[model samples]
Target: MRSKYTSFTLSIALAWGVWGCAPSTGTPHPPAAVAPSVPTSAATPAASPVTSDTEAGREPPPAEGGPLPSAERAGGHEPPPSRFPEQRITLMAVGDIMVHDEQLEAARLPDGSNYDFAPFFNQVAPIFQEADWLIGNLETTLAGAELKYTGYPMFNSPDSLADTLKQLGFTALTTANNHSLDRREAGVLRTIEALDRAGIQHTGTFRDEASRNQPLLLTKDGFTLALIAYTYGTNGIPIPKGKPYLVNLIDPALIKADIARAREAGVDLVAVALHFGNEYQRQPSAAQREIAGLCIQYGADLVLGAHPHVVQPYEWKTVTLESGMSHNGLIAYSLGNFISAQRRDYKDVGVILKLTLHKGENGEASFEEAEWIPTYVHYYRKNGKRQYVIYPVSLTLAAVQQGQKDPALTKEVLNTLHRLEKEMKLHLDSLQKQEKAS
Candidate 1:
């Protein structure tokens, strides 16, 4: 009856690439346990002074109320007066959205038949109102009540969970994770249908070959993003013989081909979601680096990863084009759990990975800024029933200290919040040095 979360942030330029150490889907193994760190991330706080990342060597943004710079031409082109031809959009993403046994019990109606997951996400809604697109990992399957609504090892949840996500402003979600097949092929199909009824966009799992073959593209403000997702495996679940298209497993060749096709389709950006890496680990493994590096090399503009169920470091890698123009791709190895019943320290953590992406009249992608808001899940008994609420870590801590009283803000909870904020700062800061060093 406690709390959980996920998140990442990045600022980088566009380039072609793809990567993730391919985990074969032919086998199914139990997923590793996550190490909780609470909430999500400590992005610049909305309650405090605005914090911006404009490091040395990075160009200062154009003066406000003035014209912006246009895209630079290769050798023979002239410098343009302004960047007026470019369009800007915002993207926000998070880590795993999990349903545990306790949550299932908590959401069950007093009538004992229906479930209402609405109260769990209200606090986090305002923050996402302006995002051009809101994406997250739907870690559990919407396999319906006939599946008995289980959790963890074989997660199946009320279809209304998808409705809750839609109401929460989730424009899209990735479905190819270790637990994607908890109920096997039927679960995957029903999950897709639930999302459909909720009017939510999803990638990763597909019910038909044609759906698998088609690209998942999201367009807004004159820019389009092609998103592809691949999990290492379905916890060793052999993807139902002859239904290879049912779920997206990590296969470099297939990914390469997919990215190639996305590029051919002329999407403004390609974001690859990878559900790999060791659970409970805060750092990405070498194989993770290899996979991410390959994805960036294969032309992915943004690489969002998960499976660690805890926050991990992010990177902005520079890739030079044949014409010598320098561009960097974003690689957030893990965003942590978006929501879960996990009680571990860091595993309880997550962030709302936010980015400001720009597209030129020519359809080139560039990044203006990135941010994350650290969040934590707060669980407590209400009217004799257990409940959970996700709160921004720093903002809530500040309020609690300033006399905002809440029954669940125990000394232990405050202590954990302080530690999460401190650690997250140190963790995210290291990325600056990492990018600079690279």
Candidate 2:
């Protein structure tokens, strides 16, 4: 799964310690170096973790950790402000979150009575409460234990995953994907129910026409984001007869209408997340570009693409509207897989796309800037037990060299990370790739 930039300041990091199956110990390293508008081989820091005492739900604990401390303390007050100031809102989004059979095994305890996914995301805690809002793609189904838990071709994970996602600070997620129908209509309905129980907002697949007709508008710090999601298809799974609302299929006209309606609604921003692209392909196909462009032209401020299972190109460009007005929009073709047992080169690599958005009191908005933090999942065997952890690549390398102080072991880990980081560079900043594709 892909990740986003957390600390442009390059200093925040989550404290590290051992947890049952949660992302376990290491010296807390700063986040990855912030990747600029162009994904160059630069270095910055990443993460802001608050160690949580509680796991999502496998076992009960007192409660999760507290929020990060604010810059201001008690008795502190803001200075006098000028008129009509613009508010800067930071938005964070990650790529596909697919739990394969191996991941299920890793999350399952020795007794196997329950499954816990909190450990999988605990290491990334700094991102938990920092962003104004965060988004992730639930690329599997939480169709309940009554159904056999499986993966890959048909993914039905435990409801506990939603508890962890809620504990991890995900305000919203897009559930419309090829896996939406993995359990058919039951999967689609149960998944949303789980999200609701977790108090998380979701878009894309819907339970009925009224739900499908109503657009999903997420409000944060008074700024609203209209989230519209659709998929290319459901891996040959047929939408139940007379139940088109069960899944959102990619349709240019429908996509345009949705964006138009959101625009008309006066929301601060419109983000269309499309789960379309070839699996394991390092680059987006020509069709991906055309569809992305159409969304931008139709008034979408951002396009969050996924399903490539690898990082694809991203661009910020000026989009001219039919009314002769121009606005900047971002098209991130794919964020890649955020967390999974997919250990193949790029499949194990992903990024967190962090965007800075500015909105003036006058109601004008702008896509101020973009940054990314690369992530690599480390799946291994420890004491004959399978373990998996996601690390911010560059920062982990730095921590090992500076803190671990084990030359031989550090060298071994660094070799693996350095190679992965280099592989990430090849797929980012693809203006040249875009030109060629055109």
lDDT value, residue 121 of candidate 2:
72
For candidate 1, write residues 1-438 as lDDT tens digits.
002222333323332222211122211111111123222123222211113424322345668976443433233444455544557788899999999999988898999878899887876787778688999999999988888889878999898899898988899999999999999999999999999999999999998888888889999988789999999998877888888999999999989889888878878788999999999888889999899888877767789999998888777655543334444567889999888998775888887777777654444455545666677887788898989878778767767768999787889888988887777866855655664566
Runs in model 2 lying further than 4 Å from the true structure: 1-83, 404-410, 432-438
List TM-score per model, in order.
0.80, 0.79
Task: Give per-residue lDDT, candidate 2, residue 110.
Answer: 81
Model 1 misplaced stretches (Cα beyond 4 Å): 1-85, 320-327, 360-363, 401-403, 431-438
RMSD of each: 9.6, 13.2
| Per-model CA lDDT versus the true structure | 0.76, 0.73
lDDT for each residue of candidate 2 in 45-100, tens digit (9 for 90 to 100) = 22211123232122223235743323233455543454555466778899999999
Candidate number of the best lDDT: 1
Instruction: Name the weakest run of 10 consecutive residues (lDDT summed) in model 1.
Output: 26-35
